[model samples]
Target: MGHPAEVEVLSKALSGIGVDEKSLVSILTQSHHEHKRTIKRGCSQFFVEDERHFERWNDDAIKTLKAEFKRFKALHFMK
Candidate 1:
């Protein structure tokens, strides 16, 4: 899924008003662990820990969310 063409498909799926759920699900469900790892690694290169959406959250809530997201990244990323 890290291939240029696959990235293009995912970009399209994510950039629209509504996601193309079927395409996204098909790609993910068919992927092997290594393929999913490739996808994860590729994604981290572009992923940002944006906090703008959480501006309204209390500091503790925001901290918790960020901590959880960090843990998720560490657990799933192919280090």
Candidate 2:
């Protein structure tokens, strides 16, 4: 399980990268640890402690992540 605050941070970060809330929720609920790890890694890679870091990611990176997130959502939903 993840802390609510951490989850909120992840949600905001995901949205910043173009993921929808429903997909975010599904990912968080179904594969909590993997999702948490991905978010943490993304945050660290982008130095994302808040919205500002989200804003700073290059457009290409954001686009790549959006694609990766879509794949994650599909895999998660299949389970």
Candidate 1: tens digits of C-alpha lDDT, residues 1-79: 3576666676566443545656667877888888876775554434444567422324553464456556656766956
Tell me the deviation in Å of residue 16 in model 1: 2.1
lDDT of 2: 0.60
For every model shown, what is its TM-score relative to the native structure?
0.49, 0.32
Task: For model 2, give the RMSD to the true fold.
Answer: 9.9
Stretches of candidate 2 off by over 4 Å are 1-55
User: Candidate 1 has which clashing residue pairs, if any?
Assistant: none
**Which regions in candidate 1 have their CA more than 4 angstroms from the true location?**
45-79
